[model samples]
Target: MSYHAIVIGSSAGGLHALKTIITGLDASFNIPVMIVQHMSPQSDNFMSRYLNQLSHLQIKEADEKEPIRQKHVYIAPPNFHLLIEEDKTLSLTVDEKVNYARPSIDVLFESAAYAYGKNLIGIVLTGANSDGSAGLKKIQEAGGLAIIQQPQTAEVSIMPQSAFDACPQAIVLSLEEIASFLNRLNNDTQSVAQPTST
Candidate 1:
């Protein structure tokens, strides 16, 4: 039940959903979380601040070369690509857009798979576009887990629908169900860290 990292992707109608899911996670969660929510450089800085206010966790726009932490949530700053480094550090790239987004979900997911291997968990949230679909598929291909919001329950169904089509086996659940699932993962991961015998 333990993983090295978690990567999430989202677009339109994502703000509230993102807040809900991240806020549901407790401060004791020790699995590195990285997010690539489609945004513009001129976008409001409220995402980090808002989630921070709502959750017990620390939320921030990630800095280049910063160490990725399990108990913290890292949001890709508007207009940058977030990648997970093998050394467990955050990497930001200014490369051309993928799927028409500077902070493409595909970029983050692919890089996360490369960095975390079987220890990656990718979640795709509400959005109007199909940005996170490719990334979610990659996570599945890399022996990791993929979760998508139930399209019917999403504010914007296209994103979740796209991910569902890409990875049919992905866990499709409601926002509350998604919250429950993540919490279980968080607790299971923490339990493993305790001193135990083989």
Candidate 2:
């Protein structure tokens, strides 16, 4: 099946995990990725800039009411909750935090599930808390793909472990495997989008 977008969530060790995955996606990858990485409210845009330099896809801090474009990665800015609207645009809010974080993974995943449904891929990476567990479950319920980093491979296992527990059908893979899988998905999508010679 073809996917339209990817929503990723992470907390502890997120920089390394995000870097690895972002680097794995080559220039041909067309899926738009939205990420909610737990960060201090006082954080700046350094993470997005750093990842942008390492990735072929455009990675930037998500802006309010911005349209979601393919081949781009939008990261929720500090102190705002990033949400996917049904119109395929992004919405940012300073609403109260969930799971003790402002840019809650659950918030992003749940909204993306509503917007993209079965065409969405929800991923939970290394984290210290179970913030994404409920959201990942919601994605699964909406018939979207749910992928979790294998707990053993995570620097901290609580988040992935919790997600696995919440989603028994989720595919568990190491970081390397996850990257390979995403690349394979990109290949499949590209093949499908190409015009077949008569």
**Could you tell me the lDDT of residue 45 within candidate 1?**
72
Quote each prediction's TM-score.
0.95, 0.98
> Which stretches of candidate 1 lie above 4 Å from their native place?
195-198
The sequence of per-residue lDDT tens digits that candidate 2 reaches over residues 1-198 is 888999999999999999999998878889999999999999999999999999889999999999999999999999999999999999999999999998999999999999999989999999999999999999999989999999999999999999999998999998888888998997887778785788
Number of the top candidate by lDDT? 2
Give Cα distance to truth, residue 121, candidate 1, Å. 0.6
- RMSD after CA superposition, every candidate: 1.6, 0.9
lDDT at position 106, candidate 2: 98
Whole-model lDDT, candidate 2? 0.94
lDDT of every predicted structure (CA atoms): 0.87, 0.94
